[model samples]
Target: MPRSLAGFTGAGYDKGRPLLVQALWLTVSTVILGRWWCPNSVRVAMLRAFGAQIGPGVLVRHGVRIHWPWKLSIGADSWVGEDVWILNLEPVNIGANTCISQGVLLCTGSHDRRSPTFEFDNAPITVGSSVWIAARATVLRGVTIGDDATVGATALVTRDVLPGAVVLAPPSADMTSPTN
Candidate 1:
């Protein structure tokens, strides 16, 4: 339910929460109803239809948001785990057979703190094939992980990682640069 803010209702966000059984049923039922319902498969299909460029048998679990479907691409046999948040304000590319763990936030947007006016920024996040992004990892914009790279749980990614490398450090935040 949306929160009542003065005379307006506000949208709620709980990206880390799993859908309860009743909530799951409600979500599936919406699929039968119409476009208002965002079933798991339906949402995936919608992403594909919007030119997400997904390969075969990709499963995007609930609570993942792809901001620009047209600019996002996922390779074959990838599993996007539960509550993984993707902000594709910029183009995002994921390689084949990759696993994106739960509660991972791939954010492509940021705000400039140096500027007097708060300006927004964004970048693409690219993950190579067979990579495992563990739970709660935050991949910032414009960072590319090479094939088979493992980003540990709760890790913050800031730079381009070499193939098969791993990092568990706080990410860098720069609001001036943005991705194409």
Candidate 2:
């Protein structure tokens, strides 16, 4: 069977905010916050103004891209490093003292391959307290990183991580075997 792009429709996709709001935010984030070298406090203030629930002492580094501030909530003392991308089509909750390192991609949306129309699928992401997601890591939709967990550099997280667990990479042969 031949594939068809004509059937694709984003009719049911709810972008929580309106188009005008999205446009304004995009311009502000891309032109001002993401590009310019601004202080973390300034970025936090902007996020709060747009309805994000950001706690005290949170540090958002330069070049970070947040898709929808309204759907984001970062707890106290969390650090979001440079070039971190939070593509939150759904809610993303980051608990206290978490460290999201540089180039990390926290994506809350994807496309359903099984659907003929290639429909959009979205889910929430939760990062518990003291969690550390290292540089270039990609956390997929609906994955929950438990408290005190550590995700290593360039790892791809597709499932839930248990508390205090360390994820080096995807669940594959590249991972070291557990010692008895």
Candidate 3:
């Protein structure tokens, strides 16, 4: 059957907060947490104020975009790099000592292509302790990255990664070109 885009409302997806609170969070994140000059402490504090469960010594760099603070939980001593986007429509749990590099996208939301309504197929993302998701990598919904695993730059992670594993980005066409 062909896809239908009409009446594609995201039914049954919970926002996890009231409209007023969500609006307040949007305003605060844009004005303060998303700025390059915002202090890490202040940003963390703002996230906590918005209901995020951030642990001690967690470093959330500037320019980071968190869609819903209440759905996020970063363990102690973890580092969230600059410009990282956590689209956590569902819960996103990052374990302790993890490093999410710059521009990484930890997405917990996706659409059901099989459904004509294109309904939400969202699920939580779990990053085990000591994991490192490199720059610009996209971790899709329902992925559970194991402890000590390393996801290389620009990698697209759609499945679970075992502990101590390293998932590198596939070689680009330019990299395979014949050199003189």
Shift of residue 167 alpha carbon in model 3, Å: 0.3
Stretches off by above 4 angstroms in model 2 are 170-180
Worst 10 residues of 2 by lDDT: 170-179
Model 1: pairs clashing at backbone N, Cα or C within 3 Å: none
RMSD after Cα superposition, model 2: 3.6
Lowest lDDT block of 10, candidate 1: 8-17
Query: lDDT of each structure?
Result: 0.74, 0.93, 0.96
Q: Write the per-residue lDDT of candidate 3 for residues 32-110, one digit (tens) a residue.
A: 7888888899999999999999999999998999999999999999999999999999999999999999999999999
Decide which is better by lDDT, 2 or 3.
3
Q: Tell me the deviation in Å of residue 158 in model 1.
A: 1.0
**What TM-score should be assigned to candidate 1?**
0.70
Q: 1 or 2: which has the higher lDDT? A: 2
| Candidate ranking (TM-score, best to worst) | 3, 2, 1
Residues 106-172 of candidate 1 have per-residue lDDT tens digits of: 9877755543444455567899999999999999988999999999989989899999898765545
